[model samples]
Target: MAARFSLTFDSVDAPVLGAFWKTALGYVDELPPAPSATRAEGLAQFDLPEDDLPEHGVWLCDPDGVGPHLSILNVPEPKTAKNRLHIDVRVPGHGSPDERWARIRAESDRLVRAGASIVDEVDGQHVVMADPEGNEFCVAATSA
Candidate 1:
């Protein structure tokens, strides 16, 4: 079996940026690690602010325990260039092209409402978007 892995993002605010990602990716907040927990365990425990915003902490996990965990960390520099690697939000679709597009559009709209803006759209392919921090990602419908 493949080894477990996750994605890490550098950010100015881990909470705000991580929240956008959690909503965009349908992930849940990862619990803060135990005081005596190992380093890795502590990484899982992200301390969210009371309002869950304007706070300090990092980490989100797939509730179903299938998808990868996400780690957001603070950095001194800002994003000055396009991302060499970005996420693709994959939505499995079946049946006609219309059905596929409908599914993809629905997810795209959901992300927009969650503070993501569309960057580009490809016919029967994918919708590119940027998070509130200008981190680009794509939403796509799977081809059978």
Candidate 2:
């Protein structure tokens, strides 16, 4: 049997992180409406405990709907330090380092406006930025 896996982040602001990932990965948020009275009444026949779910949570699937979902959880505490594991994004094509840097900078600016912090810039070749929750990710220049 294949193993099942999902990435979960203990986030102080789960909704924010969820939104970021959704934008970055082009994943859709899954939102189901409240159970209908008939459905709830039927479930109650089984004496199942009431499902008290959070009003705000995020669930995303890949474009193919194959495997692995990313779940961002809302916790009481924020991320305090650098992540031991981080994600690196490449620009998707080949070019001179300078050209790549310029592109990276432009993209970084967009992210910055979206609540990301520009932690550092390395000669436009790469940038280190933190999400709203302070999880760091790197955007690097690349050749097409």
Name the candidate that leads on lDDT. 1
The CA-based lDDT of model 2 is what? 0.69
Which regions of candidate 2 are displaced past 4 Å?
1-5, 30-52, 64-68, 142-144
lDDT of 1 by residue, 1-144 (tens): 989998998887787888899888789977666673454455446674344332445778999999999988877689898999999998885878888888989999998998899999997678999988889999987658
lDDT per residue as tens, model 2, 1-144: 988877777787677888887766567764333452443343345654344234334656676676467767666665777899776656666667667777788778877877788899876568998888888888886545
Best by TM-score: 1
Each prediction's TM-score versus the true structure: 0.81, 0.71
Error of 2 at 54 (Å): 3.5
Alpha carbon lDDT of residue 96, candidate 1?
84
